[model samples]
Target chain A: MTSSLVLGLELAYWQQSILRSLGILLAVLLPAGTFVYLFLFKMVSFMQSRLGPMEAGPFGSMQLLAEVGKWIQKEDIIPEKADRLLFKIAPYLVVSTVLLTYIVVPFGPDMIFANHDTGIFFALAVSSISTLGVLAAGWASANKFSLMGGLRAAGQLIAYELPLILAVVGVVIQAGTMNMSGIVAAQANGEIFGFDGIGSPYFITQFLGFVIFMIAVQAELAQTPFDMPIAESELVTGYLTEYSGIRFLLFFIGEFAAVGAFGAIAATLFMGGWAVPAAWADLNNNIFNLLGPLILMAKMTLVGGFIFFIRFTMPRFREDQLQKLAWTVLIPLSLVNILATTILKVAF
Target chain B: MSEFLRDYLTVAIFAAVAIGLLLVVLALGKLIRPVRPQADKYLTYESGVDAVGTAWDQTPVRYYVFALLFVLFDVEAVFIFPWAIQLETYGWFGAIEMSVFIVILALGLLYAWRKKVLQWL
Candidate 1:
């Protein structure tokens, strides 16, 4: 987990390639495996209020495969008179936008592609693009319910986006940099302009920023208490009503990937991103260095688990309630966070 | 190997991996749902009532006003962006050019507003 050893630059390109490929290969496999094991088998069974996947691979692991097979065997049906082009393109649009946000996410200090300065802003901008696709799918299906769902998604995306961007700006103002790495760096060494620990972990200086960031992100993900976009009972799975076969699958995968990405970003920005927890900080440098990325993963899982807990504990909010929460509560709170951060920046 | 071959090989590898991942994801998803075959199953469900023909039929005429207004403002803003970006360099000359353009746009909006055409159900 030491940043230097993590890259293994001393190794030949081919050796490095071998390790990189192996790492990504395993990275791809582990989560996908857990997704299949956890949600597909365990959760679905839990959903039915029954013991699940008990007979197959350990704890019904193979049941995910079986379920996948069943979804495949179903007919690929395009609704009669649906707008063929938009209907076909919408799922791709949604998934591609979600995947694009991954470019700046730091899995470890060395584990990112181009860190688009204003990485936070770049993400917020791109995340909003999915609403267009959802809108197209909803309107193209020509289904009233689907259109309403899509419209809801678009409105929710539009409204929450303001507060979400404002919240990120609050953090950016506190750190005085849009570069995520720089923001995290500002948090390091635990001192801000002679104020001990003010320049420390972002969550410390901009705790309000951190709080708003989490809320806005959860809303952006359309998670519990904020998932007005795809309220099934209200919108019949919303813009997704017309999709079948692979297209439908892409939407969910995009959704789950989004959940993971939000957790990663929150971990990176507010959770000290791979920084060893304080108790472990007292250990040897050699030990702490190796433990950082691992600790980051633990942090990510903790945030991810919070998402699952939220989903389980809350019910879908009424559409009006969702709007009111965003406009009244989240917006004012986010604005206050930004104002406070700005004042601190100027004062400092 | 030739450069052409290298280029083609790289493109092929990229395409293959991306396509492969997409296909596997979709394939796995398709394997998960229950498939029952019936005429009703094939039909679009509308609260158990038969869909009156297809679902993707025409919407009300009111949306046209919204669409037209969106296009008008969107184009106006779009045209202004280039001018706005270069406003400092162009100074008075650019400001005059933009004001004339906006005046013409304002007239159109005023005309539309007077006609009560902007309102939609």
Candidate 2:
């Protein structure tokens, strides 16, 4: 019996090491592929009233693959006057931020890579680094449009970032914890608006914050309705105007991946990551350990789809209009949300 | 490794690997892609105007005022977060203090508005 127990412990150790490696790999690579189709081709095409990528794989699933192939064959161009070093490194910097964010994402109750005490803050701080990368791309491109686009991105991101972080502060205050899993657990136990049966998701209690967070995230991602930074009509894809081939592809991947990352974070914060309702508590069995990510993905898809819906349906905001919304509207509303959440928490 | 270092190490590793993967994919693209740079193609695009003078000319962009304002409010926003995390512990005292803080900032915003600093010409 003792020998068998030792063998079991030995196996468990190896299994854990293997799982750690796999988790890191998935966190880094999966976001790049998971939503490429939904966000890139289908959603946009549907809004424009056409079949997207009908000729590629089954239901055009392979369309992205075909496009990647085509992009690879295209020439990598560098404008003669462009700053070569920054131009090359800018896209990578953005990618680095997106990847680092996954480390703290709580995929399940126990399925997080790192449940740092500063989880939400860590994600927010890392995401801000991408703005610097964007500014670098614009400065290095040596083009008027690129320069304008870069400055616009910097301003928009900085403005929207406030509301985004503040909105989460509501949820963070409610949960009374900064760790990602702790936030989820709080939601799982929470009741919505004092309703006994209704499971608490911050989406209901923090509705104002939710709306503001979603809007701010949309702007932060540079999607439609807030895409002044890359306004093709005015800026010709903005900071991306000078890039071609694989460099352009890097930016594309980073953007779509960011959409997924933000979706994941929002779902974790507002929708209650990996939490089933109390009524269905029995369903939260050992199987949840396996399906936890799937639950998170389902929530993420809903959040991301809402974002894409807004992106495709809404008109782009002008540069000044975008700044005004972030500063005058979102900032004030989020502050009010914090004040309200504080009073409510203190009273009840 | 300690849990703290391990967590951060994973983050660093994830970043390195992600950048590396992109580099490999781009490298693969470079291997098969053709490179033909013509003189015209090298010129910066300026709506087909044969690219006039350099693109570095200075123009009036009035948004910098708002940019400074953003810095002020953003710093204020940051201060609210830590206070928010410890809010319940501090109770009503914290609440009243934060209200006064926000009221002061709101006045700053009001001043800026009256001065028309927020107007995007």
Candidate 3:
């Protein structure tokens, strides 16, 4: 078996695989748990002027665990008319897609699970798979609300997906590579018109793309303002209307985990990713492999905070308004951004 | 296997591991959770009222139109990625070529907008 070095230890391929599997679990669940506790539990409560869950383990820190225990003991219900097979499989597909997206994100210099040439592209592609799961859950449930939620989610996801991809095109043009690590390296080594004090993170050069990407991400995650899919007031949690117990828990985890995954991707593309600026540290130092995950988590928290903040503050958009924003406003603007980026990239 | 294939293999393994973990939790839940097969419990939820018509009714045609537009732009996105990575090499020649491509797609979006197809209702 082939061997690879991790933390200065040589290990066999199988051992490395086991370690990586554990890492994937952490990468997905840790961020999900953190976001749920920090944003969903505490931040939202504070925003609403409440103390939040102070009873559960030191200021409601253990509320998530308590919620999980409550969910596990609840009955797993399948409606009589529901397609049992598809209903059972939907959450698996949704959660697994979120897990798969983390593979392409680089934590440290050598901390990536997969270093594909088309890393960011792979991440984008796998994320859209959740749309299928949403649609399936909607259709399989055989409920009017689920069906409406499913179709709305499908239309919304695909519409916002264009802007998301187009927004990344600007990043790809600036970084000159779709590889996530390569993009981070470019930012680390870059200078702002010969000023090397702070590397030229793409967020400055590609600010329009950054804005469009975040907006698209907001819609893609179906958070408020663009959350027509699961507009709880209207659609009764939308495609998730019929799910109960563990299945609902799976979807809940998938939603927050996706927020983390996309937040990490956004940080990688626009916020200089896992690297400190060249002025601060040498890019080649092996210490990054250790510090990188921590750096990424911090950045992810910033981006996730921004996402959830908007989610809490903003009112939901009407269906027509949501579609109009993606198709008319975001898409055309992203296309123009791409054109301008390409011109400047070639000119300078 | 080649290094390229090995990277993909890791992805496949990770996918399996995710599903496996979920399944383990699910099985444990099944062991603990109660399942009383009540008839009304299995009926679809409709805000505490009986469901009306079947949910398999036809949806609006606007959805299909949006799907078609998505396919068109998705292809454009695919084409743009390769050109993006190699833009430094392609220079103005590549820039002009991609410019023409993006303009055409934008025009299509404009056409959709003018036709009111972009509108949800």
Candidate 4:
């Protein structure tokens, strides 16, 4: 049974894939947005022993929905002196790059939109384009605070991008394919710790890569210790200072979507994607393709929860210290991990 | 269309959809949201002080140096990716080649470090 095209255009084989891709994009955004809002606010608030946004929905669950309404109705402010064109386009550029990342995300077994051979590579490269949007937003704002924010973003993302890609290389080496599904398949092949009955995830063998990736992702998301770019206390909401209302809302959505996207990538890379645990090893049967996305979402929640937990708990790093952590620390560590991984791959 | 073309087409379509969504939201918000402009609000915010000359001041050159350094290492890191995916087939031969490449890059980083080029002013 195939989905009917509403546009009245005759469908071809490849068009079906595009249709399915658009369907997944439409379906995933609501849940992804909800998951980001609730998980971040609740987890951060719970850490601080405070109730967050409880008045809006049950335990403030409906708060983000209400926020969307309020933001849509609020005034859209473009500063008078700002570069009007870049100011307007920057947020869309960011949100679009992030939204595009969902295209390659493997939702389930054979459940991906586009199963490119360069899947992981494609996702990383496209997401980096959001940094340009960030710089544009900063430069066009005509605010010194925004300029600093943009520069910090450029410096931080550029420094962390190396380690992030390098860390993934360890997993890519082990998995033998850049395809997201192939990485999951590699993880599902056998048990880790031999007797533990859990699938041997790359997280176990590539522990250093996992650590570096997590740190780099934290920086990539610009949260907490790595959130120097948009630190409210210092930069007055940083690059976002001049933005208000709907344009600001675009950046907000883009940031959360990026967190969700990166979390999905990390889940796919190190946590065995959609692989059901050993107890459900038999359930890994290809027929239960629907279970893949559910399993993947569960893993994402755990990883994302941990990331938000650390975000809430950690203090902001000094600017130089943040760069130092990426270069002097994560880069060298990821390199060592790659060397070790190569040796193991050769010997075994 | 060929599958390769379709794959990239999906990316283009996704981008179009996102931009379209942003435009829709902004247009909708413009219909609903209140627009109140005042002369005071238009001035650049300098801790609420009156009338700053201009915000487009010269930023320190330190950020430029880091960007240059980033380009150097980031380009070097890109080579590791293709080598990584093919590591098993080429075995020790590929491994040794990668090590020399990495060692050279490491020396560059070390050289920059000793030169204090990496140090934040």
Candidate 5:
């Protein structure tokens, strides 16, 4: 049952746990830092015809470090009227949920933090815990803008949560397993209408579900076009208005880390996770344990880049329009996608 | 301990690690960061204007309604997950049965929509 090993060495469970802990840290922070530097800074700047930070380290690569340095020395602030304890504890809740999400994601055949049976379900369930932290921050801040932003975030998240959950149902039906590793195995073994050249990535068949999932993810992250909660023009950065210094840094990291986490999930679900095409490599080969994380990271970059590209390009959706899109459009479409997938599953 | 429990232990350990890491960073911040406090600085930010009314005022009831709708669908989604995994074994019977279940819920959503419960106002 000891599924993880480095090189040829067999390690004890405590050793494995330590390794896994470090892996989880690397998995979460690397992508968070990558997305911040690549998409948030460099890509957006290039799109806007301006060079982003080039002074930090080779094209502002060290900008994240600089930002961290700057944020750490600043004062941590809590308003006089705020519920001091909840306001202080809120960022922990948000960032921890983001960290918890990485637990279920399979970085390699053996390189998962925790191999839960209900992997995707567990990830989805824990991810929503951030909403509670958000509400707590808003309520405790006792600021009008914070309250409105928090409530709007709650509404937006809940509305999109359905589509997000339902969209995965189509993939679940196709793979016939809720386990993250199992789903990756299915894709690696799957053939598109008897053609096994490219192992069937769910995105080809679950394209509708994929689209819905991405849209819901955008809304969940409160990215543009669905960023009413954090809409600066309106709510003044929403629930985040009251936070400062290290607490604000925690939320910022959580946001990008979440982007990384969701990007990893999407890559696993729609792309063939860490495995190359079955025709190319035997998935059971131990080589995957080494190459898998790198492959997954590349896929995550692709997915994260797309998400940020859309965030920068789209105009913010009106509040009513946002709710209407989730309820009327995304939900129904995802439900229909489930029905179609189920029918096809049975028919075949 | 059972392997199943071990799996969860890893999760708990990771959670602790995450919190520990955050605390370490926060402690580091506390050591280096200056805490120059001013009375005005502690006041709630209101875009350079003096505060008006308290923010604890009543919010729109629409958010509550949406929460109710979310609960209904969220429960439905939970039920769907197990069915989705077991669909192949259940075959057409499961497909048809779940279709009926989904349609019924869809009808509920439609009812809410028609009644304008989903409106943001």
Candidate 6:
């Protein structure tokens, strides 16, 4: 069935797979986005040593619900001077751009949608377009802060985008494939110091590269130590200063969605998304293939927790510092990482 | 998809569904919620004061310079991509191409640094 379908481009299977992938993606996205938002919302309040939404529904989890309810019913305000078309279009654009990146992410064993040969690149390219949505949102608001924020986003995204790609290149070199599952598979089959496959993890194989990747990802997500564009005190919530109510909700969803997307991607590439750790190789027999996939999710959730931990702990960087890191440190490091990767390919 | 085609299809389908679902949720929210737009509420105001002054705000030229320098480097950085991609097969040739590319990239950085642009930020 698989071979013959392949020969004929089986439209039914293609259609079915597409539908199934969509269902799976929605399934992952809803839960992932909700998880990140709820986790952060709680963490933020918890750090202040105050009780968060602990009454709404069994633990104040329904706080997001009440808040979302209030936002939805709130008056939709449009500034008379605002560019109306762009104003209406901006939020949806930003929101769409942010969540559209989940197509290539592998959630469990062979569970990715549209597993492109260029899965890594596909994710990168799609996510890159989100900056445009951000930029548009800023420009359309017809406010100076919004414009500045938009410009900042454009600069920041364009600036750090290279280092991000370069670090991913190192992973590609080590894994010997660009497809994400392939990267995870490489981790699964990686040499463990020749003791019948007992080599160190990819992090050990390419320590510098891993650091570069992590920092670049931090920059890409505009997280702590790189979050200049949205520095609330400086630009007044950056591009979102003028947005209110449901529109504000859209922007909010977009931001948290990115956290989930990046978390999933990082898990797939570096932390071995759904792939099991080395000690569990004996469990790779036919009967345990199912368990192998669960191991991958466990790893993903672990990484997601760490990301939330960092968010709660770190402080934002100044715009100058953000640019400096991108241009001076990240760009140079990216170039050198590429150089090392090429040398490793040739010499090793 | 023989193992190969399934992979590509997976991505395409997933992308469509995530985006579709997000829109659905958002649109559903709008449909269910009652929107009330008041004439006075829509008035342009800063800090709750009305008709204080024109909305055109001032910004430093330095940020523009930062963006300009950023664009130049970003475009140049893309050059390394093709070479890095073929590194496994091109080996020494790819390495040499990359070195030359890096040299030019380094010079661009040098130009930015000498002009004290990075210092400005």
- Cα lDDT tens digits, model 3, A109-209, are 98889999999999999999998999999999999999999999998998899999999999999999999999999999988888988898999989999
Q: Label model 5 with its docking quality class.
A: high
Ranking by TM-score: 3, 5, 4, 2, 6, 1
lDDT of 1 at B57: 56
Candidate 6 lDDT tens digits, A99-160: 66776776655465566667788788888888888888777777666777887887788777
Who is ahead in lDDT, 1 or 5? 5
Fnat, one value per model:
0.12, 0.53, 0.87, 0.54, 0.82, 0.45
i-RMS of candidate 6? 3.3
What TM-score does chain B of candidate 5 reach? 0.93
**For residues B1-121, could you state the per-residue lDDT of candidate 5 as single tens digits?**
8978998889888888889889999999999999888999999999989989989987664668878989999999999999999998999899999999999999999999999998877
True-vs-predicted CA distance for residue A290, candidate 4, Å: 1.4
lDDT of 1 at B25: 66
Model 1 C-alpha lDDT per residue in residues A1-348, reported as the tens digit of each score:
112344435564334434543444345335544654675456656866889778767777787666555556666767766778888778777766665555555554555444555566666656778778888888888777787777777656755665666567666655556666665555554465566533367776678877777777777778877777778777777778767766776676677767666776788778767553333344225554456556656766677667766675688887656655665566557655644554455444
Classified by CAPRI criteria, candidate 4 counts as medium
Candidate 1 vs 4: which has more lDDT:
4
TM-score of each: 0.70, 0.92, 0.97, 0.93, 0.97, 0.86
Clashes within 3 Å, all models in order: 13, 0, 0, 0, 0, 17
In order, candidate lDDTs are 0.62, 0.82, 0.92, 0.81, 0.91, 0.70
Candidate with top DockQ is 3
Measured by lDDT, the strongest candidate is 3
- Interface RMSD for every prediction, one decimal? 8.8, 2.6, 1.0, 1.9, 1.1, 3.3
**Candidate 2 docking quality: incorrect, acceptable, medium or high:** medium
List of chain A TM-scores, every candidate: 0.82, 0.91, 0.97, 0.92, 0.96, 0.87
DockQ of 6: 0.45
Please identify model 6 stretches exceeding 4 Å from their true place.
A1-18, A192-200, A277-279, A282-293, B1-19, B51-79
True contacts kept of 5: 0.82
In terms of TM-score, the best-performing candidate is 3
Candidate 4 chain B weakest lDDT stretch, 10 residues: B46-55
Which regions of candidate 2 are displaced past 4 Å?
Answer: A1-34, A282-285
Instruction: Evaluate candidate 1 and give its CAPRI docking class based on DockQ.
Output: incorrect
